[model samples]
Target: MAPLVWLITGCSSGFGAQLVHSAVARGDKVIETGRNAATKLKHLEGTGAAIVDLDVSLPEADVKRIVDEAVKIYGKIDVLVNNAGYGINDDYRKLFNVNVFGALSVTRAVLPYMRAQQSGTIAFVGSMYAWWAPALLSVYGAAKGALRAIAESLAAEVAPFNIRAIDFEPGFFKTPLTDMAKIAQYAPTAQPVDAYAGHRAAMGGLAQALIGNERGDVKKGVELMVDVIRGEGSASGRKIPQRLPIGEDAVRVVEGTCKNALKVIDVWRDDVVGTTDRDGFEGEKDYEAIVKGPDAQV
Candidate 1:
């Protein structure tokens, strides 16, 4: 088999850096991109992975340029990982611009090539917080949630083209991205509100406590991703999960949220059902049959 070509963003550190190393170790060609490729990714020299300076938050022309460079190096991209993202303290707009729009822009730029090739995988590195919105990270969670929705919808849209989209939702892990000092530098002060003063202070304390305390192993997570893409290792003999939740905490949060949602839905079933049209017309007596007809395709 021919070696797979991978284009990954945000290779400066965290999951992106780990993925680049893992892919290269497995003998796959990688086009590793970061905002400051020269300094941020200087350690990757002589690793056989091509480094490109790419800030996903940039405009369409910049995104196109990066994609063009990757294709020029490897001929065709077999996989595209939309992993460039960061959290801002109080700037929801800034966070969304980078986390949501940034990823979307990169995906948009690569779709044409993936569609033409008729074989490729796109993975979005979202967060477990997307499903379980924790306090203080509401905007960050929202951005990830949007990415999750995009991946799900894109999966269905591109299935016919033999292109797959996967959303990897990971919990906290040990990485420079979660460093308290680094985070504090970027964290903006909350707007002073007497009612939220205590809550704000508690959130600040929580952020500090979580630094260096994350339990998920970065290496293992990257390995799992590599396996899924190759159809071997942990993902062998199993269908690729549309949304693969990583880490113990991530699994628990996803499962617990699902269970809680089901319970709430059941409790409110009567009220929810009552909202539907109750009028029984003589012409349409078989309402249930009509409603349960053939599934619609988009």
Candidate 2:
């Protein structure tokens, strides 16, 4: 197979950095973008990867420029990794702007090229919190949840074009992104609330402990990702999961959430079914009929 061209966002650190290394090691061409690409990513300059200065939080025009540059350099992008995101404490707007909207913008910019080519893979670096929210991390989790929702819908929409959407749910990885000093700078000052004091303390403790001691290995995770993208190695002959959990903790969280959700649905099955009016009542059934009718818009 010919070497693939990869365009990855947030390449300064964490999964993005590891992914760049892995991709380059496999002889794949990479366009690595980060806010501090000139300095932070300087070490990768002679590694045959093009470095682009890109801040995902920037406007659409900036994102388009980055995409254009990537295409110009690599001819085409075979894969796109949206990996720029940060956790903010209680600041939902800020979190949503960078993690959700920024990623969406980058994906949108890359989609036209991928669609024209009729083949590409877009991987989103999401988190386990997207599935199971932990204390004090609700804002971050909500942003990731939105990203997951976008990836799910996008997979169906672009299937005909052979463009694949994948979401990587990572759990507790030790990286600069999880550094306490950096997190504290990005995180808003915690407000004193009597009722949630204990929960807040517990969350703080978890963050501190996991900062430099996370169990997930970045190198191994990126290796799996590369294999999955190539449709060989460990992922050969297996259906690619739309949501790929990257660690033991992520797997547990996703499975546990699914199990608990199913249990709830089972418990409420009778009541849920009873909501429909059975006796020729115009309800959701009528709506379904209309939706399934010939007049329904595509």
Candidate 3:
């Protein structure tokens, strides 16, 4: 088989950094992008990985330049990983700007090529928080939730073109990106209240609990992603695995939450399926009349 070509954004640190290294280690050609490409991920150049400066939050035209550069150097891209994201503790608008819009911008930029080839894979580094309700991480979860929804819908839309979308839902992985000091601005603030007087306090407590309980290893996390990329594991999809939960904790959360949510869904599953048209009538014309209204003009 020919070596796979990968284009990954947010190569500065965390899973993006590890993924870039892992892909290069496996003899795959990698093109990594960062807002500051020279300083962050420049180390990958020593491993023969191409580094490109790309801001996923930029306009489509700018993103096109990045994609064009990748195609120019690599001939073709086999995988596109949407990984450029940051967490804001308070400035959720900023977080959404990067995590949600930024990711979509990059995804859209590379999609035309992937669609034309009809044989490429797009993986999103979604969070377990997207599936599970982790308190105090609402903004981050919301952004990831958007990505998850997009992946699920895009999976169906792109299947006809033979393009696969996968969501890598990983639990917390140890990385500098997790620094509370750095991401403090993204956290919610306290305000005087009487009704929900302790809400902010409760949120802080939850954050502490997560810090104490969550188990994440950068090496292990990246290895799981590599396995999925190589198709060496049993976690396969019918068309494509729309979502792959990495780490034991991630799998546990998905299974548990889904079990509970499934019960609720099972109860109302029939209600969700539209059985009849809104216009319940004796004839097609009658239905049309009902829809249009009797006294209304066409």
Candidate 4:
């Protein structure tokens, strides 16, 4: 098979940087991009990966132009990793801009190229927060949730063209995004209510304690992603699912959330409304399964 061409965003550090290395190690071409690509991704220059300067939050025109230039480097982008993102506790406007809209803008630019090629994959680097919400992370969770919705819809939308979309939910990875210290930047801007001060302080203390102790491995996670994208290793012969969780903690959260929902539904079957007007609606609708289609079908 020809070497795949990968374009990944937010290559400054974390998953973005690790994915660049992983894809290159697989003998694939990569266009590593970040805010200041020349400087931030200097180390990847001689590794057979092209570096492109890109600020994902730039105006749509600028993002499209950058994508066009990156596309020229590899002639065609076989895979795109939407890995650039960050989380701010309170500066959610900026958070959504970079994490959500930025990803969308870049995805929009690349879709045209993918559609033209008629064979490509787009992987969204999402979060475990989407499955299991955490304290003080609602804003970030909302962004990831939106990503899941988009990824699922997109997977269905583009399957006919031999394109695939995968949304990966990674747990508390050892990325800078999990750094509790960064929260201090927004401290002055926080508007605290006296009623929840003590509880909020306790949560803050817990977060501070977990700063350097996160267990997720960025390299291993990226390796798994690359393997899945290439259908190699344990992923061999398996049709990649529309959504996946990267870390063990992420898997646990996704499972727990699902089990919890089932338990609630089972316990409150009577109160789950709309049952009274069954009106020949006999069985449960496996709508998600229908919408997702069989992996083999894709």
Candidate 5:
């Protein structure tokens, strides 16, 4: 196969950085991008990967220009990894900008090229929070949830053109993104109320503990991601999962969420199933789920 070209966002640290290393190690051409790419990503100086400065939160035209420059490096882009995160500040607006809209803008820029080539993969680095977020960070989870929804619908729309949009929800991983100390340095000072102080403190303590002792390994998780993208190693002989949960904890949480949803649906099916246009439509007796199998996705 010809060398695949990868344009990845958020290469400054953590999973994004690890992904650049992983892809380059596999001999794929990589355009590693992030803010201050020449400085933050200096560690990759001699790795043969092109360092491209890309601030995903920038204007759409700026993003398009940077992506266009990246595409010129390899003449085409085979994969896009939308892994940028809220850097420095946890302001809710910036969180949505970097985590949600940033990816959308970048994806829109590359989509034309992918459609023309009739092949590509777009991976959105989401979080377990998409399923169930912890306290004090609901906004972050909301952004991830939105990204997941985009991927799910975009996959169906683009499949006919042989492009894939995937959303990867990883549990707490040993990445700078999960570093509570760094987050504290940038987090805004709290305006506390007497009644909520205890609750806020508890959530803060939980975050510090969980982030400090994150369970997922950065390199291993990124390697698995690369394998799936390349259709090698563990991903061989298997179709790439459109919504992949990165670690055991992520899988467990995702599974629990699904089971809980199914339980609610099963409990409410009879009450809610026949209410809407049941009489106007064909007799609902035979409206049972037509697809019945353990592996059924929908």
Candidate 6:
């Protein structure tokens, strides 16, 4: 097959950068963009990929301009990697702008082209928080959760058109982007009274360790993603879950979650669907209808 044309957002750093390298290594054509595309990914020149500036939250017209440029260059976009996003310091609004609204805008821009071509993949870079909610990141979690829902429903809507949607939820990866504290979006304020001291401490410990620690192998993650895109025989026009839970601790948590999910299903099987009808009178003679039949009269 001909080399796939990949349009990746937020190629400045982390997964996007890694993925660009991986794709280029495989001889794929990549149109990588970011908020500071001119700055973030300067080295992409020799990597057999192109770079451009893209702020996902910009106006619809601006996003359309990007779509136009991309289509002009590549003829058609084979894959749309919606990886340009960031947390905000302002709790809800800023996060919404970058993460949720911007993502939607970009997605909407390319959707027309994808549908027209009748073949494409849109991968939303979601977070594990979208599934397992954590403290202090409620707004960010909500944004990702919304994106996941969008991907899920959009899949059903676009399936007939042969457009695939994938929600790539990566657990904590070590990168400059992982420096949540300095990002202006995550500066913590004073705590409330009577907090669960132990739990709060534990959660904080986990957060720092996961976000701050340099553990994830970017190369490995990117390789897995490329595999997802190239792997033949995958369900066409459906969500390809490259839901990578990086790190050993994340692995344990995911495993335990899987186990618990199975146990809960087993325990609630009867309750969920019921084995039999309750011991109630089968006939109306036992308990007459609160509102009598029309023929029964006033």
lDDT of 1 by residue, 145-195 (tens): 999889887887888999988899999898877887778787778656788
Which residue segments of model 2 deviate by more than 4 Å?
277-298
lDDT of 6 by residue, 39-129 (tens): 7678776787877788887887888897788778878888888887776355477678778888888888888888999998888888767
Where is model 5 more than 4 Å wrong at Cα?
Answer: 87-90, 193-195, 276-298
Q: Candidate 3 at residue 256, lDDT?
A: 90
lDDT of 4 by residue, 233-266 (tens): 9899989888999888899999999899999989
Query: Per-residue alpha-carbon lDDT of model 2 for 125-215, expressed as tens digits?
Result: 9989889887777788888898888887788788899898888888877887788788778766766788988987897887777777888
Residue 253 in candidate 3, Cα distance off native in Å: 2.0
Candidate 3 lDDT, tens digit per residue, 1-298?
4789999989888889888888888789999889888887767778788888988878778878878877878888888889888874566887887888887877787888888888788889998989875555678899999999888777767778878788889886776656666556544475535665476579667566766355888877887777776664553442347887888888988999989988998998898746564765445664575455222111
Estimate every model's Cα lDDT from 0 to 1.
0.85, 0.84, 0.78, 0.85, 0.86, 0.74
Find the 10 residues in a row with the least total lDDT in model 1. Answer: 289-298
Clashing pairs in 5: none
By lDDT, the candidates rank as 5, 4, 1, 2, 3, 6
Q: Candidate 6: which stretches are off by over 4 Å?
A: 180-202, 211-215, 232-255, 258-298
Worst 10 residues of 4 by lDDT: 289-298
In model 5, the worst 10-residue window by lDDT is 289-298
Ranking by TM-score: 1, 5, 2, 4, 3, 6
| Backbone clashes in model 4, listed as residue pairs | none
